[model samples]
Target: MSSPQSRFYAARLAGTPVFDPIGESLGKIRDVVVLPQARAAARAVGFVVEVPGKKRVFLPATRVTSIMPGQVISSGVMNVRRFEKRSGEQLAIGDLLERTVTLLDGSGRATVQDVGLEQNRHHDWMVTKLYLRRIRSGSGLSKLVSRGQTLTVDQSGVKGLFGTDTEQSAALLLASYQDLKPADLADIVQELDAKRRIELAEELPDDRLADVLEELPEDTRVEVLTGLDSSRAADVLDEMDPDDAADLVQELPEQVAEQLLGLMEPEEAEDVRRLMAYDEYTAGGMMTTEPLITAPETPVAHCLAMISREEFSPSLAATVHVCRSPLETPTGKLLGIVHFQHLLRERPDRPVGEILDADRHTVEPNMPLSGVTREMATYNLVSIPVVDEDGRLLGAVTVDDVLDHVLPDDWREQDEPPATTGQIDLSEIARGIHDGDTGSEPAGTAASTTTRREGGRG
Candidate 1:
């Protein structure tokens, strides 16, 4: 990074946009991955850059060409696969900051406020400074009058800040990542090693963990769920959608699944059991029991309000299932559906029944996955209501559910194989290309286009 200051703090680097070689926007920096060394400064390995779709991928420090104000420029070649935390690597924001450490000067203990990294003469980035806030102790008037001293110290001057055994609190880490989407949060949790994963999981509330479990790979979520106490695991399952809960329950041993189901509320457990009765590839299996549903006489405003809930997925929110009398699923006979668009266009005082979409297509609960996909595709619907023999709405199968089942089972595991370099010296090739470009450039223009990797540690 080309900053007037010799060092950069991790907090300031967060959310900084990163661009490719040709100045095309790549992504924004999320976290710096570091390998904490026992004696020397921690070496920065790469950055976790959140690309489009909230997919975080690794950008090696070696590829960084220039670090200008507000953004970073890359060499244009970065692995697009999801960033997984290696065994020895730690996230500067996720793992280090807000941790407790002791000062070697015998002053007192302090909480890490920030980490500072600087490029050495060899152009290798290393964590050499720590911004700290001294921990204060006292009570009543004394505590009110005292304030923690915030200061910067050399990395070598502190102890207990590195290694797996270091005491760290998940509170600050969770707060920093609170804005992350469930998918993004799941990615970070999935990449954490077993111990850290469980530690983080323990800190997350049941509802949040439920959302994360829905996004995580099957094996990882199962491991996390099982890692929790039985009561908490049951509560987490209760928070998950019935279909997702059923799928997770089915993955567990029958005995364990039965125990958890028995522990859940009777209503929620029944819903899951009903879903588990269906074949894994059937519409009944993939449908969510919590889609937006309302009585035929419900006001357009009420239907719109129901779909506006933050808990509802986009597909579920796109349409409202209008049914008779009982609003809950397996709702009384399916009347029809009102598209969100129609609801918006209609007067708020109008009933949803008056705005129902024509040419409705509904699928039977036992309908095969292929048949459901075909019907949804034929109707160009984001969600198709699933009904029973009596035409009562059981649930709705959404586009996301269909895609999830259709994709390969390993699609969630996004770690790609490491890149391979042949015997040819890649550095030599980079030098030759840069030399040619420099020769062709006019005046100082070459400096702006030059790759930072040239004429540095290789």
Candidate 2:
């Protein structure tokens, strides 16, 4: 990153075509990883690259070539494949994510999508830079081109997510971007000091700034609040989840938070204020105060109809909680979680309870984040509802938020074991290398052993 005074920002690379060894075209960039330059580190620690028309793929600062106004060039997609091959084994999802892809969108973490896997006729399997689309859906930054002139792809003149470049290689990898995916864009903003945060915030578009602000630490939120106008600040908060908005507002001085909330819609601001009463680190705090709640008795069609009226989409309808009473009066109680996949699986006439996660593990209002984190692991839950002493459903905790809890600050540098590393003892390790653990591992290895170990490796 360059000094704020400097017009050029080394870290805010908006456009750069990533390449594979043989010049295979990958995607253009969205944002730079822009890690905190902890203690005079010559290079950035992480790199956040929004694959044009895809999710942000994090590259290490080591992979960065040059950071410019409209672009950031990077290196190392080739290395991902080579590293996976040398180990002579199958890589885990986390292994592919070991690349330092930062979520510059402000959310702290991301997920692994499709790993660039290739299998030869000889059955040699190689893992590559899992071309992640997005966590849930693909949507990220677009590369900036000559004013009004976007990069067009391969004579088609069709622009990609970040716009496409001509003469693109067929091997170009792209990922998805989803509204639910968590991004580290907040951490990047936090990494900057007050002045830089403001400067960077000013440079970013309002929508992008809104996301980064929502994702940043509360204290940073307080510091950055002074940078934007009261209206702008309120607008940013308005665009955020009510819970996240409260989180940021709580960080500011009481007067400021109050003032910003005042600027917001009275109902939304009130909801955020109610959420602020609880400590953010706890279940009461972590769960959203205003989630899409409705009565289980409500006809599915009616509920869906009402859902279309909601300001936010029912995209997270899987986690859409239901109760017998209205959201205000609160009765009946949380019957179950409605899994979108299941809802779609069953006929619309089937009750919501039938589709709800019968076995979902919920956290109490006072439960600590630790409990929430543990449940996240135990159930592999995408979202967990938080209830009160009466077991009344409050809000839910989604997986993207928990991802930060799973990974360290320098997660990109973390080394993950191969799929067979767990099963690899002295003998199995050698057998895995020579005999092949890429699925076929002597079917008679005992169903129980394979069930627990083979699946565990995955």
Candidate 3:
């Protein structure tokens, strides 16, 4: 089998199609796959495609005949059954997806939706187990309410629900919500070498794997992908937010970046290209491609519905925002911003306009640093929107971004401030030690390293 070139996963692949070696249709590419390793690059190897009317299937890198502008060609010879129970890395989606435990009643059961995680985003769901209850409402009004006897048991008991593992003792402490934080799980997953990441990811369900991966760091993320192989990594990145996907590509070496770029859909890759073209410091820089965009006439409820579907990142939860359409002339016009906390404080059903701060402050493209710095200081803004002359919003200037320019990171001072000119302080030596800043101490004479007592000995 010929190797897929190393450059295969240089950019994120979204909306790319998948095919069997004989050119039979399979699914749309969802994520690229890589084979994990320890330190060396994770080999770019395969793809996970969301097949229509069928379960998502994994396509091996070796089977790929060629990756072109719009499609992936492969020989339909790879077996996928082995990947079912594999997990590429240790990730939290397991706790999020489902877990088996013995309920307080002592009957073994599997949790359906983690009510714990829902109420407390940081909840360690393993403690609270919500089971599936079959709806048996047919006869009488009383029938709707169970006498609390008919329990819906999963075809398999608790262990069966989790597939391979047996139920733990009722006394075993479930992982605490605090301990199961994504940041914690991400750190743990990153600790695994590339090989372990691929192995764990392969074992994990493709959909679940995609969710957990969104939290990992760039280098570790690439490791996971490289381990899975280029093709699979490509598909996974496609499903990620465009900004995150661009962040990942920019971190890779140029050679690798170009290779992966070829495997992705043209439009998605182009979006990533535009994002990468900016400096990571300026307003054109650090700006995200994943802005919440809306047409000027878009109904408030309609726009909110789209935002609720996890289209925007949950990590950026409270800051969900919206933008204006391109045809409206002002390129990056601001529709409005919503802090979900404030949104929730009001009834969810209210139109977004009812709560928008119409008079919120905004900045423009050519605004000078002196004005911007003062604006930031006065308003105490965490992020200030940067707009063009027509009130078209372009990008937001985050505090860190502003600092990056005000204080260039690489050129920061250590202990002393940068010298004004290269001129030395000659006056100090000429004036003698007695006249120096150390006023209390006696001045030292040159001959004795410190003249015995001003002039007693020389």
Candidate 4:
């Protein structure tokens, strides 16, 4: 009801931490839930907050006490139910960005860059400002170098924002979310309806989509992949880790899976095919074929540089597999491995082979998931190497891979209520918010859907 700032831009508000009155962390503001009006500004009813465990729930706007630079203060009476879009509710970042609108003075149309929300005299928040960028035409060198005029205008200065004929795309939305981690971006894609999800996925670069696909649930990954043409789908698959790509391929129909494999480049497809040969529960299936690898003769300095790459996940970079020539997986004999710590403590000029961890354990490809788990636990290692019967390195299985297999199939979905914070009921609090004596208010509801579903901020 009270505020540190009278207005806040939706994009800047996103990912801002939310805190209880006592200064304890609740979660983060993921998005604003707004209801559009025919001739009035859209009313913001609540927010989609991503709480602990990546679970998203609704936070009524009336309960927020202040919007500061890096955080939001709340009354802490949250509705722990998974947030869902009602019949007419629209997500400010998910559904509104990139909407084409006509200028009031008959000026050229522009796309919605961002929207600003502020509380009215009645303490009800509404979208009252818009950031617009003029639409530009043509492509090539000129298009890349030229700039479009941008404006900061009152919401009433633009039309067609909520019209059926308005052209809306995912271009600007994706740009606004460009800084989000792949996992965070995947959360947003999962919450969108099937149509919008595909639209956003199609607009992402192959490499970016590949990273996002690896974080998404199996069904959603498959759905997005199937939405693309075979050529593009294969390209995305190539960009993903072989193990993840194989897992996704297994979820597809046999014929469709084979077709996609054929469309992929021979080298990339070969890795996926090899991974698919083993049972899904075996170490072979869980290990990534693209682990950080180096030849025994490679300098420790070089191995350290390889592990430092941004592309490698922390688990994968924990140790470097040292093999004979043909440093790639399935290389000559698995000589040994050098942990990053070892590489760091030794002289930079030393060869990695001199610093191998003699006590490290290796697992056979056929080893079951249980065996892999025990191997990692017993050795106190972040990852274990998988070697062929002939003593050649096949790949390395990380702790994350084992957890993925051991956890419940639907672990990613946030269907249950959050840990209890208070005894208050959200419905009662919501009712008190709108019943106040406010002049000429637009009618709307904060009621969520009956069927529980997975969702997150966009």
**Cα-based lDDT for every prediction:** 0.82, 0.48, 0.48, 0.82
Ranking by TM-score: 1, 4, 2, 3
Q: In model 4, where is the ten-residue run with the lowest total lDDT?
A: 449-458
Task: Point to the candidate with the largest TM-score.
Answer: 1
Residue-wise lDDT of candidate 4 within 15-128, one digit each (tens)?
A: 999999999999999889888877678888788898887767788777788888888999877776777777677878867788889889776678888889988898778899
TM-score of 2: 0.49
In order of appearance, the predictions have TM-scores of 0.81, 0.49, 0.41, 0.77
Relative to the true structure, candidate 1 has a C-alpha RMSD (angstroms) of 11.0
List model 1 lDDT by residue over 1-458, tens digit each: 45534578887899999998777999999999888776678888788899888888778888887666788888887776566676667789888888888899987788888999998888888899999998886788766655667899999988888755564677776777898889879878877777778888899998999999999888998899889899999999999999999999999988999999999999999999999999988999999998888887889889889888988889889989889978888789998998899889999999888877888898898887777876776667789999999989999999889777765576566344223354423233234333542122112211122322232212
- Clashes by residue pair, model 4: none
TM-score of 4: 0.77
| TM-score: the better of candidates 2 and 3 | 2
Better of 3 and 4 by TM-score: 4
Q: After superposition, how far is residue 327 of candidate 4 from its true place, in Å?
A: 2.5
How does model 2 fare in lDDT? Answer: 0.48
Backbone collision tally, model 4: 0
